[model samples]
Target: GSRGSRGSRGSRGSRGSRGSRGSRGSRGSRRSVGHVGRVCQAGPTPSAKASSRASSRVDRGLSQ
Candidate 1:
């Protein structure tokens, strides 16, 4: 009987807390941070770069 009581208490303690304890008990089940997905930072395609470079040459004198 004592072991059963203790086992139930232990299960209750860990059942819904998600690891955090005491004062943070209320929000313990909540996830604080999550990542959506990876981000790609590859530069513009070759054609895009060529067009930008061409335009830059045409505007080089005006930028000064």
Candidate 2:
């Protein structure tokens, strides 16, 4: 009865998209920030450091 009354939109639409978008947005922001930081700190071995930092941030993002 509840599902029928809700028309299949309430459960699927609200929960799925919100959680996915929210997590994706946070991870995207963190990755972009890390990239910008690496660019600003360009010097010797910037790629090495940036890659490691970016992976770490991704791990943290998934954990969150």
Which candidate number has the best lDDT?
Answer: 2
User: What does candidate 2 score on TM?
Assistant: 0.42
My TM-score estimates for the predictions, one after another, are 0.27, 0.42
* Residue 57 lDDT in candidate 1: 48
Which runs of model 1 end up more than 4 angstroms from their true locations?
19-64
Tens digit of per-residue lDDT, candidate 2, span 45-64 = 56546655665566456544
Q: Please, what are the lDDT tens digits per residue for candidate 1 over residues 6-64? A: 89767755542323332233332132211111211343345444654554444443332
Best model per TM-score:
2
Query: Residue 58, candidate 1: how far off, in angstroms?
Result: 68
| Residue-pair clashes per candidate | 0, 0
Among all windows of 10 consecutive residues in model 2, the one with the lowest summed lDDT is: 55-64
lDDT of each: 0.41, 0.61
